[model samples]
Target: MSGSVNMDMFGTPLQKLFSLMQLTLVIAGLMGLVLLLWLLFRALMPKKGQTKRGRKGK
Candidate 1:
């Protein structure tokens, strides 16, 4: 029917909006995870010049 065709055309924009939103959420979550890991590593690591081998430099 003519009405159905009109409805289908309108649905395309909604689909595109949802796809973009999903992509944004995925990228944001991955970036957050990377930042969290970096913070954890920094917190767990030793301070500068604390290790005997670190002073030797290699």
Candidate 2:
């Protein structure tokens, strides 16, 4: 006897929606991580021309 397999159950609109949601979450997480790293770098770095701000030319 030969058996036939059905692929109709997996090709529904719900599957597409779930895939889209997963992709959105992944992208959002990556952007949040990048922002956190940038903030840390800014806080740890120093300012430039700090001594020349208050003094004028003699």
Candidate 3:
């Protein structure tokens, strides 16, 4: 059971992979935060005018 595990990558590649993962997570989190802010802003603010694409009472 002691010699049953093996991994190929050791130092540099693993560090690079971890860095890449961190960067990707940061970017995704920022994108999600921006999307949430945009949605909240749209939901909380009053509409200024009738949308040209409105089809409700046409």
Per-residue lDDT tens digits for candidate 3, residues 1-58, read: 3233213323468766876798899999999999999997677553635544444533
How do all models score by TM-score? 0.60, 0.58, 0.59
Tens-digit lDDT track of model 1 for 1-58? 9687557756899866776798899999999999999997666556654654454453
Worst 10 residues of 3 by lDDT: 1-10
Q: Global lDDT of each model?
A: 0.75, 0.63, 0.66
Off by over 4 Å in 3: 1-11, 49-58
The best candidate in terms of TM-score: 1
Arranged by TM-score, best first = 1, 3, 2
Candidate 1 similarity to native, TM-score: 0.60
**Candidate 1 regions with alpha-carbon error over 4 angstroms:** 1-11, 46-58
